[model samples]
Target: MKKTIYLIIIVMIILSWNIAYGEDLNLSGESYVLIDAETGRVLYERNAHKKMPMASTTKIMTALVALENGKLDDKIAAKGECIGVEGSSIYLREGEVLSLKDMLYGLMLRSGNDSSVAIANYIGGSLEGFVSLMNKKAQSIGAINTNFANPHGLHDDSHYSTAYDLALITKEAFSYEEFGNIVKSKSYTADREENNYFYNKNKTLWEYNGGDGVKTGYTMRSGRCLVSSATRNGMHLIAVSLNASNWFNDNYKLLDYGFNNYNRQFVYDSNQFIKKIYVLNGNKEYLNLVTENSLFYPFKEGERENIKLSIDVPDTIEAPIEKGDKIGYIYTYLDGKLIHEGSLIAKSTIKRINKFESIINKFKFK
Candidate 1:
């Protein structure tokens, strides 16, 4: 009995160790998180819930609220108030005029403080109003740990965000085509009235493959900060790092882990045959249902065997169905737990049966 108890204790220790360090993870940062943009699922994390100074990443939220509330094509006149706002500038001259779109390019790509203020003033009539909008937008998007004291992300003691909240905000920003386009740009030239041009300040665009536009920051108090995004194959991952000693290396390492260990595979393609379902009193006895878009899943290496696919389809769907109508659902499972779901849509319309055929079908059912 003594020997058996000793062996059981040894086994429990081994099991606990395996559970604690089994994910092939190595990371260093005060707060960090990698997330899938499409699904908003956290792939890896370290201290992700701890709120810290986010530095220039605050511009992401500023840009988002500005774009959502203000028109892109509207002209913005650079006022004296925008001058000397401090830290990263597109060098806007007083009284200079540019479209809101050009200024955003300047703001996001160049990380321009002046442009940030210009946008804030143009959209909200004052910086305080714009900051209020930023905070409101953050709350609405589930960024519970975020607060915006200024539009440019200047280091204010009150301004802070958690890794998880930054990821959430970025995922929301990615939904805007304008935001996505601006961030991915490696270089953008903003022309002033006299043919003066300013180039983008983000250096990662030139350094990494699929390194689209995001933001980077460094302050005496905030250390080095970066919000980077990349797409390879069909997978797009967003990485947020705050107060890291090595921003670039940490981001690259996190991105490499994501791409190397996980895969985005198409479980189902649009208009492809999922299965056939029976139809009642319809012109066609059977109808084909398929996905409208390719369903992508991120699976760990060698873990595909653990994944399962299941389809939930209704029997005898009613007639007069419209094409592309949702008819069923396809679920992807891991270890018998559903991880993802895609809609199964009708491949083509199913018309109602003629009166004679309907009568015959009714009699057959009886």
Candidate 2:
């Protein structure tokens, strides 16, 4: 027989349509999305999957590819291709040198077109090669709708991404601690002698509470784009806007809606003991089991009442059990729909009792 356990823990799945939990927001973006960074759940969105030019938000992917492939402390020289790039720039002169770390500060904080090229050329061996890396990274991280034509978010008819895709990219970029630190900094001073000072262009870091990231973008072709993130009350949220005249206010409302209507709830910890099961012939009479992974998910108010948990394992097992052995599984469900599943494992090894010990114990009872 299967043993089933039910508990009132928070649970839910990503909604298929706009959920009617908070006030309707008058967001200005042609395409926009707000997501729970911890669970990758979409809280709110409009035209979020429609492909459109994302402007300088493209740098998020650029920085992710470079950080994964290159070292931060290595000094990289600006190549001739990095000179005279259009739009925002830190104004790199050919052969001018800056650490890869400093160049990333320029790429994200200053929105430097030149910095993007410099980092790309050095890390990927060429601009074309680096753009390829960005696309590959995007696809690897499940941002299948994203494409990269250049290191900088310059207008290319072929270059475009969806609001949802941008949010995914930003979430992946934020996974790197250095990436978070760079985007959140108000200003940075490069090791180079001239044009060393750079100030962050993303004003969300200053104007909004708990806003620590991310990037801002504007181009005549792409309009104004912004990808922003905030952490409040132990919840981290990512908001993306494409071609919005009021992106700052739009994102602010979107984030407010999420923070106000939802909360991050802990569901399971890998170290937490699940249950004890009888061991048929072990030296110990029983063996403890624990979850194999931790789980946290965002839940709306009242959803906790519907949460349920189930476990599947043998009622009793033979001895010689090993630690970390996958004995069964724990499944979490909400409203009868499965939301999360975790592995159940033995917490410690249990050796079988020898026949001589068993015979002696019987004699002692007699």
Best-fitting candidate, scored by TM-score: 2
lDDT of each residue in 207-279, candidate 2, tens digit only: 9999999999999999999999999988999999999999899899999988998999888887679899987
- Per-residue accuracy of model 1 over 37-67 as CA lDDT, tens digit each: 8877677777788978887888889889888
RMSD of each: 4.0, 8.2
Q: What TM-score against the true fold does each predicted structure earn?
A: 0.82, 0.85
Steric clash pairs (candidate 2): none
Instruction: Look at candidate 1 and tell me the lDDT of residue 195.
Output: 30
Model 2 TM-score, 2 decimals:
0.85
TM-score of 1: 0.82
